[model samples]
Target: MRLFPRAGPTASMVSATSIVVSGGIAVRGIGLLKLIYAAHVFGTSDAQDAFLEAFLLPSLLSDVLAAAVAPALIPALIRASTEGRTAGAVALYRAAFGAGLATTLVAALVLGLFFPFALPVLASGFGKEKSALTLRLLLVMLPLLPLTACNVLWRCILNAGNRFVLAALAPVATPLASLAVLYFGAARWGIQALAIGAVAGSAVEGILLAQGVYRLGYPLIPKLKGALNRLGPVLQQFGTILLSSVLFGCIPLIDNAMAAGLATGSLSVFGFGTKLATVILSLGPASIATGALPQLSRLAVVGDWRVMRGSLLHFGKLILLVTVPIVAVLMLFSGQLVRVVFQKGAFSTQAAYEVALVQRYSLLQVPLAVISALGFRLASSMAANELVIPAAGVGVAVAALADYQLRRILGVQGIALASVVTQLSVIATLGFLLKRRMSKQRLGVHTEAVPPGGDAL
Candidate 1:
C-alpha cells in the first residue's frame, strides 16, 4: 500500500485530507484576521469581554453539537452506501437534516429566552451594562447555532458522497463575512456588526451547501416523518455524543466566566490567548480527522485493524509533522507572536505579554490534545461513542476542581493550566476505553439498521 495513496479510497482519503488542510489554513487565516481586527477594536476592555462571551456561546454550541452530530451520521451513511443503496443513505440524510434543524431551533429558542438569567452564569463578572449588552448581542447571534447545525448536516451529506471541497471551504464564508462587517460597519454598528456577520455568513454557507447537496440528487427539503424511528441508532449515538459534547463544551463558558471576576480585562485576555493557541493546535488534527474518518470507518467495517492501526499512526505522524515545529515556535516567541498578531490599535503591550503567558500554558497540552483528538475520531468511526461520554464527564469533573484551585493561585493562566489538566484526564480515560474497544472494533459495529420495507425518502 502506498504511504500516500494515489487511487482508491485511501487516495480519496489523502486527497480529501489535503483539501481540508490546505483549505483549513485559508479558513483559519480569515478567522485569525477577524480576531486581530476584533482585538484592535476592543482590546482588553469590558466591552470586548462581553462580546467574546456572547459570540463564544454560539460558536461553542455550534461546534460541540455540529461536530459531534455530523460524525455520528457518517458511519450510518457509509454503511448504507456500502450496502449499495443510496436511498437508504438519502433517508438517513433527510431525517438528520430535519431532526438537526428542528432540535437546534428549539435549543436556540430556549437559550435566547433565558439568556438574561444565563448571562450571569456565562459571564459572572459583568456588571449591569455589560450583561445588558451581552444579552442583546446573544439574541442576534442565537440563530448561529441552528444555522451552523443545518450547514454541517448539509456538509455531512456532501462528504458522505466523497465530495468535500464545498464543506472544506464553506467555513471561509463566516470569517470573511465577519471581516467585512468589522471593516466596514464596526465604526457605525460596533460589536453588533460581528453578530450580524456571523449569522449572515452562516446563512450564505448554507445556501452554498444546499446547492451542493441538491446537485448530488438529495432533496433540499427536510423530512422529519418517522425521523426518530428511521434514525434509531444514529439518534441513539447522537444523544450519547451530544451528552459528551455538552460535558466538554461547558468548560470554555465556565473558564471565561471564572476569568470575568478576576480583573476588568482578564476574560478578554484569556479568551484571546486561548483562541490563538487552540486555533493553531486544532487545525492539523481537525483537518486530518475530518478527511480521514470515512476511510477509517471503511477500514474498521471490514475488520482491517492492522491497516486501520497503520492509518491511525500515519495520520498521527502527519499531525506531529505539522504541529511540532509550530509548537516550538509558539513556545519560543509567543510574546513576539502575540505582539505581531494582535498587539494593535486598542490592544496594548501589557495585554500582549499576559496573553503570551496564557498561550504558553495552553501549549503544553498540544501533544496529548492531538493524540486524544485522533483517538476520539477513530472511536467515532467504529461507533464507540459510549466511551466518549464517560471520558468527557471525567474531564469536566477534573476541570471543575482544577479550575477552582488553579484560578485561586494563577489567575487566567491558571484556567489555561486547568485546560491542560483536563485534556490529560480525558486522554487517560480515553486510552483505557480504546484499549478495550480495539478488541471489539469489528464485532462491535453499531449503525442505524435499515428498517424493514422502509427508506422511502
Candidate 2:
C-alpha cells in the first residue's frame, strides 16, 4: 500500500528491478501483440475454445514443472556459483535438466496415451467433434512439455549467472513465431495452424535458450548419476516447490475446466482476458520476482535478514506503485482497451464486451497476485517453501468454492471474480505467515545500514 519505504530504494533494488522490467516489457509487449493476432484470427469460436482446451494440459504441466525446478534451482545455483562451486553448479544444472526432461517425457507419453479417457472429464461439456479436435491438437502439442521444461531450466541457468537479457528475451521467440504463423497462415490452416505455430515456437524458444546457456559454457546434458547427489539440497527443496506449484497451477486448470461447461466461447474469453492481465503481471511482479530471487537467496544464505526484509518491502512497494494505477486504468477502460486491441476481423463487438467484463474482474487480482508472487519468491529464497504449500492450498480451495458458487450466478465473469478473491485470501495468509516467521528470527532486531557495496547483491 505504501509507495515509498522509510529507508528509500537501494541501487541493487533499482538495478534488479530495471533489468527485469526492461526485458519484461519487451517480452510482454510481444506477447500482447501475439494475443491480439490470435483474437483477430480465431475470435471466440468453438475452434478457439478447443485449441485453448488442448493447450491447457501441456501449458499447466510445463509451467508447474518449470516453476518447481526454477525456484529451487535458481537459489541453489546462486549459492553454488557464489561460493565458487562451478562444478557443483554445473552438476546441479545437469541434474535439474535430466530430472526435468525425464519427468516431462514420461508425463507427455502417459498423457498422450490416456488423453482420450481424460479429455471427457476435463472438458465434460465438449461435443464429440470439438473433443476430437482438442485431442488431436493436444497430442501434437505434447512435445511442448519437455521443450518448455528445457527452456525454463536454461533460463534459470542464465538468471543464476545474472545473464538476464538472454534469459528474458529468449521467450520472445514464442510469440514472435506464433504471430508470424497466425498472420500469414491462419486463414489457410485455421486453428490447427495455431497449434502448429505453438509447437514450432516452443521448439525455437527452447533451442535458442539452450544455445544461450551453452554459449555461457554450461552444456544441456543429462548427467543424472552424480549430478543428482551433488544437487541434493535443490532436490530436497524440489518436492515442496513442486507441490506448491502444482497446487497454484491447478487454479487456472480448474477455472478452464469449469469454463468448458459454460457457453461455447467462455473458455476462449477467459483465456484472452487473463492473458491481458498477465501482461501486467509479467511487466512487474513476475519480472521483479525473477530478478530479485537470486539476490534474496544470497542474502538469506549469509543471514542478512534485515536487508532481506527491506528488500522485500521495497519490492512490495514497487509492485504496489506500478500495479495499483494500472489496475485502475484497466478497470476503467476495460471495454475500450479490449475493443482497440482485439475487436477486429474474427473478433466481434459482443465478444469484446464479454471479454472486457472478464478482463475487468480479472485485473482486480493483478496487484494481489503480484504481491503473492513476491512472497513466494522471498519464502523460497529463505528455503521456507513449505510455508507456500498451505497458502496455495488455501488459495485453491477458496477459488474452487468461489467458482462453484459464483459461476452459476455470474456465468464466466464469476470465474474471474473468484480468482481475485482467491488471490486476496492467499496473500493475506502468506503475508501473516512470513511476518510471523520474520518476527521470530533475531536478524531483524538490528538497524545497521547495509554495506556500500550492497548493490552487488
Where in model 2 is the C-alpha error above 4 Å? 1-10, 381-383, 442-457
In Å, residue 404's CA in model 1 sits off its true spot by: 1.9
* lDDT (Cα, tens digit) per residue for candidate 1, span 1-457: 5556566555656678888877788888998999889889888887787788788878888878766766678768887888788998888889888888898999899888887877877677789998998888889998898888888888877777788888888888989998998899999999899888888889888898889989998998889899998988776666677787888887777787788878899988898888766786556656666787777657655656566666667667766777778888878988888999898999989999999999889887887778888777666544466778888889988988998899999988999999989998998898899777666654665333222211100
Over 200-297, each residue of candidate 2 has an lDDT whose tens digit, in order, gives: 89899888888889888898778767666776766667777778888888899789888888978889888987777767876766677677766776
Give the root-mean-square deviation of each candidate in angstroms: 3.7, 4.2
Q: Could you tell me which 10 consecutive residues in candidate 2 have the lowest summed lDDT?
A: 448-457
Question: lDDT scores for all predictions?
Answer: 0.79, 0.79
Clashing pairs in 2: none
The TM-score obtained by model 1 is 0.92
Task: Enumerate residue pairs that collide in model 1.
Answer: none
Q: What is candidate 2's CA lDDT for residue 418?
A: 94
lDDT of 2 at 244: 82
